[model samples]
Target: MTLRRLHSLQQWLKEKDVAYAFIQGKANLFYLTGFRCEPHERLVSLLVFQDNEPCLIAPNMETSLICQSGWNYPIIGYSDSEDPWRLISTHLSSLEIVGSNLAVEKELLSVARAEQIKALSPELALLNCEDTIMKLRLIKNDKEIAILKEAAKLADFGVEVGVHALNTGRTEMEILAMIEYELKRKGIREMSFGTLVLSGEQSANPHGKPKMKSIEKGELVLFDLGVVLEGYCSDITRTVAFGNISTEQEKIYETVLTAQEATLSLCRKGTVLGDLDRKARSIITDAGYGAYFPHRIGHGLGVEVHELPSLNENNQDQLQVGMTFTIEPGIYVPKVGGVRIEDDVLITEDGYECLTHYPKELLVVKP
Candidate 1:
């Protein structure tokens, strides 16, 4: 799979007349090389050439792990005492790749790193390859979809754990810990992002942090989280009432659910990506909760929790088959709490498939 992806990227480089591609993003590295690593402050990159075989650069300690990941290409491992950029320059010179146009992910490469790369050869023109890379990753293959389905199942399990752990006096952090602990027990080493267990007014903050505040009755508890499985990701958000919620809370939940469903109904091939968001926003606006519905309707979900094809009112991109993303419609009213319904969706040739199977109906958990 990685070799096939590399071949596609190399073809793009040749078509664009670029000689080399310096891929530095961890996700991009894993997508093209099958080796996933969090190098932190250390440098880890994949250099793909239009003609020559690609090579991977990483910290010396992780070289074995990279090979174990099925990467048979040449690898350059740097020690702490060595300057990686200098080594990279020497390696490029050895490969006779100096003074050639190199494509790099401008969004991921820092100014310092770019300068170091430029210093390697004054004649090298740095071109941005982010768009090409994104286009390549936008569509999911059958294998990727299968892995995503499994990841979504784990996300459903996570929500189940959160709902079961909910109690009147339990702190948000406590419930969050329980969810992560259970996932760890299931062999999940990392979450796509931080697990959010916001309750009551805290949920109104959208991206609020889980605090020590105890979840109380008559308030909504929101679980916004995803697990990283096999280098892919799954994101899901489901809000439930602690006990008997007020009439207004019920209205909010139902409205959000309705909006989400309406948006998801349009997830088919040839549908405008932005139209989905506009449909949900229109419903929310007509229901007089437009102002409360901040943020985009959803985001593309795959190697990263947030990737491409952002679901907003202005983007005019059309939906395509094998595309996986989230359709989350939320309404957040301060002091009154918030309600968000999120589901991972896949655009099919005929229609769409909702990868997440967790119940979306409002569940009033008895305190």
Candidate 2:
């Protein structure tokens, strides 16, 4: 699969008349080479030439791991005392790549690194290839879809653990820790993002941090989290009542749920992506909480939690089969709290499949 992905990129490079591509994004590296690593402050990159063989560069300590990851190409490992940029320049020169046009991930490359790449040769013309790569990754193959389905199942388990851990006196962080600990015991080493356990008024903050604030009766507790499995990711959000809640709170929850479901029902091949967002937004707006909704309806989910084809009010893109994304509609009313229902969705030829199916009915946990 990695070789096929690499071939696609190489074909793109050939079509554009580009000589080489310097891929530095961690996610992109994983997608193209089957090697995943947190390079940290070190430089880890894939140098792909249009006509020559590609190579991987990383810290000396990671070379073995890269090989174990099924990378069969030349790997240039650099020690801490060595200058990797200088070594990269020498390798490029050996390949007779001077004066050639190079493609790069403009969004991910840092200014200092870009300057170093520029210093390699005055005649090297750098072009942005981020869009092309994103377009390639937009549609998931059958293998990727199968992996994502497994990841989404794990995400459903995560939400289950969170719901079971809910209690009147338990702090938000306590539930958060329990959920992560359980996932870790299940062999999940990384979370797609920080697990959120926002309760009471704190939930009003769309991106609030989990706190030591105790869960109380008649409050809503929100769990927004995702797990990373085999380089793919799954995201889910569920807001449930801790105890018997106010009718106003119930209304807020139902409104968000209705909007989410309406938008999800609109998902299918050839459907206007932006209209989906509008469907949810209109529902929330009609419910008199449009001002409470701030962020986009959802984002593409795969190698990264957030990727291409953002589902926003203004986007005019159309959904295609094999495209996967999240459909999360939220309403965060200040002081009254918030409610969000999120599910990972995949567009199918006939319709769409809701990957994360942990139930959307409002669950009122007994105190």
Each candidate structure's count of clashing pairs: 0, 0
- lDDT (Cα) of model 2: 0.91
Assess each prediction's global lDDT (C-alpha) against the native: 0.92, 0.91
**Alpha-carbon deviation at 162 in model 2, angstroms:** 0.9
Off by over 4 Å in 2: 98-100
Please write out the lDDT profile of model 1 over residues 227-259, one tens digit for every residue. Answer: 999999999999999999999999999999999
RMSD of 2: 1.0
Models 1 onward score TM values of 0.98, 0.98
Model 1 regions lying over 4 Å from their true place: 98-100
**Least accurate 10 contiguous residues by lDDT in model 1:** 92-101
